[model samples]
Target chain A: MPSLDKTVAEPMIVFDGVEKRFGDNVVLSELSFTVAPGEHVCLIGPSGSGKTTILRLLMTLEKCDGGTISVAGQSLSHMTHNGRRVPADEKHVRDVRKRIGMVFQQFNLFPNMTVRGNLIEAPTRVLGMSKDEANARATELLDLVGLGDRIDSHPTQLSGGQQQRVAIARALAMRPDVLLLDEVTSALDPELVAGVLKLLRDIGSSTDITFLCVTHEMGFARDFSDRVMMFDGGRVIEDAAPEKLFTAPEHERTQAFLHAVVDR
Target chain B: MDNLGTFLSVLSQGLPFTIIATVGGILLTIVLSFVAGLALLSSSKTVRVISRIYVEGLRGTSEVVQLFWIFFALPVLVGFQIVPIWAGILVLGLNHGAYGAEIVRGAVQSVPRAQVEGAIALNLTPGQRMRRVVLPQAVVEMMPPFNNLFIQLLKSTSLLSFVSINEITRQAQQVLVPRFNPQAFEIFLLLLVMYLILSLVITAIMRTLERVAAARVGRRPSARSRRQATGAGVA
Candidate 1:
């Protein structure tokens, strides 16, 4: 496994005073966090506590109503224009977004595309890799995800676990610096969740990619994440090492949330 | 029997015009449908407004009225005459294309929002996302609706006779109404059978297309299973 301590001086992801709202409902209010390179950070919260929104914001799938987001030391919410910082343009967002990838709760694989096609699409289209190069990368990733035999099959043919693995491979194929897992295994059957979680664990241990994951599986959070942040009401209530956060939550809200999760 | 043979030959003579107009109009409809469908999704308000206008303008009016206006009234206004056959094709194409555009828009929109988010997460350009991810899935949804639109288009071609284009209906009225007035009933029955055959052929073709599209998405049932489910060879 690669050393997790060789991160650059700057953080890989930064959300400073981010605020997000959907109509009258506030999803994330003044939420802020920093993730170092090669870290595995897990976000755990009740439903609609804004955990998923954090990942979506980082992926640029959703925009923040206020505050700035920076990825790899570059402005994601705004771009420099004439020595002034203005809201980022589409091109700037696209350029900044190339460094990130996301796996969704639904797996969300392209049913029309073969597994190989799904894995190679972004690499070839966005990264401009040659077809041969993309194919080779896809094959390797499929093998890593234990879906090498299913490369030619469409996503609809795969089981939910297999589809989620393919979705993981598809995200990894882009060689993103930051990978967002938005409740990735939440939609999987109970028996199928372990395999996907184990695959993610292997990826986290074997690669240098930074993972920011939102998941309800407390066991996986304890096992896979270096840090677990307890969230409620669109704010991080407790941020601690997994052992500390899971075993001895300091805040009353964190204790109540953990008790609720563990009891259920 | 002799009268039946003559009626068949006369209707066959007009088959070329029906075939030409149906094929040309459908091809034009497909093109305009895609253009208008994509325009509805365009970022520019002008493009969206123009698409709305085209779809609504054609959809709101009567097909016969549009055909007559294009064939009869437009020539007087523009001082240039279009051949009746071409005019029929143009009107049918524009009219059906307007309806088909709604199908395209609805199918495209029906593609799950998560699929689009997955594409965006990969940092694909908007065009790449649509072409590579969204459209492939949306095309499957669009195919079934397109089949419905195509049959409607086929039936609409029968109205082209109003513009003096001698399609099957016109041919039946021209030959049977005057020459063999007493056998008008039989001639009309033959016309009905011809239209039925055309519709059946179209249904078969569209069914095959739908199967091929379903197979692409891995939704195709196995041949054995399909046969078992439908109880093939039961009769």
Candidate 2:
């Protein structure tokens, strides 16, 4: 286990007064938060409350309308130019984004590639790892994801749960410091959901990689997260430890939201 | 009956030229289509504008008029003349290539946003993303449309005969014009059969390629069959 004292020395991600809007709709307003290294944080909310948008922002998939986002003490949304901060250029964003990996809700594995090909692609092309080294890393990651024997299979050949696991392995192959999970299990079969959740729990507990997840699985959130943030109307309405937040919530919206989720 | 022999002899004499023009035109079309399609996606406004102008200019005008412009007008402007066969190849290539660019652009654009996002999340450079991920999938979608375009290009080669290139159609006209019988129907029917055979050959080749591409992408056999059915019907 990573020591909490060491993990808190510096924050891994910081969103300062972030604002995002799509045309007429505001997705996130003045969203601010810090994720410590090795910390596992979960964002739970009703649909369209900007839970996935937070992860998308970190991955640089979506740009913020206003405010700065920093990863590992470096500005992701801005570049420092001669002592002044301006919007980040493509090169700057690419450099900062190299340290982050995202597993999407749809398990968007490359359909043209086999499982092993998907795993080795970025490592060889982007990271400039040797073919042999990438192959070895892919083998190890497949083993870690418990799909070692299935490395030759195409993503379409796998079940949804298996595909999600391959996606996890592919993300880990980049060796990112921060892993963003965006409703990773929401698309899975009900019976197949637990197996994937168990794999993620193992990954979270065993690695020092920081996790920022958006999920609807309340039970998994309660058991796995170091902190649970309840979002409503594009803002964090409740932020607390899972034990306290799940049992003794402070915000009315949080209670009502939990009630609706539980009833479902 | 003697006219039948003359028709066959004329068609056989013209067959090589027709085949050469079609093959050369198709090859040039493939190259131009990709160049124009990728230019349409370029970040530079100038490239995008230039590509759009080329695609629209060629696609909007009649191909036969364009061929005449190249064969007749271009030589006066440039102070040099191209051979009739080369002019046919150039005009056919550019016109079909312009139409083909749309197919390439549509296929590339149709790749799911999620897949592109996945590539971006891996920090693949824009070039690497397109080459390794985007194009491989786009090529699968492109094959059927490309087959259609190639057949259209092949048929368009018949227009080259108007420019005094001795292709099948030109030879058939020569056989009909001097003969007293003026057996135009028999000669034209033979020309039609020749075109039909060429189209069927192209369809067979493209279907084989589509199946190979589909296999590489691991497309399901059922989906492959459905696509093949539609693809054959379109061809």
Candidate 3:
């Protein structure tokens, strides 16, 4: 595990007064947080608490309506243009987004490509890795995810657990510094969920990659995350280490939320 | 009209022209279909409007009228004349191309939204996403409707007769019917047979294409398999 030193290093991710909304529905308002390098932070809350929106903004899938988001000290929400704070252009957003990878709840593997094809496509086309190098990367990563035998299989042919495992490998193939998991196992069958979660825990433990995960799988959050931030109405209502937050959450809302989740 | 004489006459005088127009028109149609279809989905308002004008303007008007206007009037208006064959192709291409744009648009839209989000997460450019991800998936849906339009376009080549190009219908009316007067039914039967053969060839080609495209995306032709794949996929 990498050291979680808060001092003597620039943060890996910073969201300063970030605001996001759709039409009249305000999802997140004045949200601010910082994630340290190599720290696996989980965001947990009620279903509509803008947990997934946070990941979407970080991935640049949706632009923040206000404030700024920075990755490793580079602005993602805005770019410096002739000394003006301009909304980041496509080129700027793509450049920042290159360092980030996201896995969806749906496990959106490219149905058109095999497991190996999914793993190597972006590396070859976007990152310009050599074909042999990309194939080698796919092999190593598929083996890491315990999917080495299924490298040539199509996604639709696999069980949900296997497909999610492929998605995890696809994200990691990019070698992102930050991996965003938006309810990765929520779509899995009951028996399959544990296997995916176990694989994720193994990956989280072994890698130095910064993780900002959004999940309703509270047990996995407790076991896998160093820090868990309980959110309500887009604000971080409670933030603490998993041990303290899960067992002795101070806020009434956090206590109540945990109770509701644990009961369910 | 003697069936043999009609067949030989159309083959020598009009068959070449018909083939040329169909081949050239198909090429034009495919190009326009993709260009306008993608433009319809463009983020730019001006591009969308420009493409909409082309699609609607061509589709709303009659192909024969447009052919006449391009062949007879366009030269006077623009100070240049188009050959009869080129004029037929342009009109036929633009007209079917408009309908084809809708097929392309709907097919592209049918690709699941999550699939696109996945592509974006990998940091692909919009163009790359369409080419590498979206189109490959959408092409499976396009082949069927595109086959319909291609056969329709082939039959529509008979319209080239009116524009002074000696395609099948022109030879049948002015030459074959006049010479063989009482025996015209045989000539029409032969014409029908020829068209059926062409349509079947189109069906064969499209089926082969659909097979290749479906395999690339791992989509089997059976609807039951599609249902199961989709049901378990997103839900």
Q: How should the candidates be ordered by lDDT, best one leading?
A: 2, 3, 1
In the range A101-190, model 3's lDDT, one tens digit per residue, is 999999999999999899999999889999999999999999998989999999888999999999999999899999999999989899
lDDT tens digits by residue: candidate 1, B147-228: 6677777788899877788899899997677998888889999998997787767767766776887788777634543333
What 10-residue stretch in candidate 1 chain B is worst by lDDT?
B226-235
Name the best candidate (by TM-score). Answer: 2
Best by lDDT: 2
Q: What residue pairs are clashing in model 3? A: B1-B183
Off by over 4 Å in 2: A1-8, B1-3, B180-182, B220-235
DockQ of each: 0.74, 0.84, 0.73
Q: Which model, 2 or 3, shows the larger TM-score?
A: 2
Fraction of real interface contacts that model 2 preserves: 0.86
- Candidate 2 lDDT over residue span A139-193, tens digit each: 9999988899999999889999999999999999999999999999999999999
* lDDT minimum window of 10 residues, candidate 3 chain A: A1-10
Tens digits of per-residue lDDT for model 2, B104-213: 99889989989999999999999988998999888888888888888888889999988988888888776555672467777788889998898888878877887788
Highest DockQ model number: 2
> Scored by Cα lDDT, where does model 2 land?
0.89
Candidate 1, DockQ to 2 decimals? 0.74
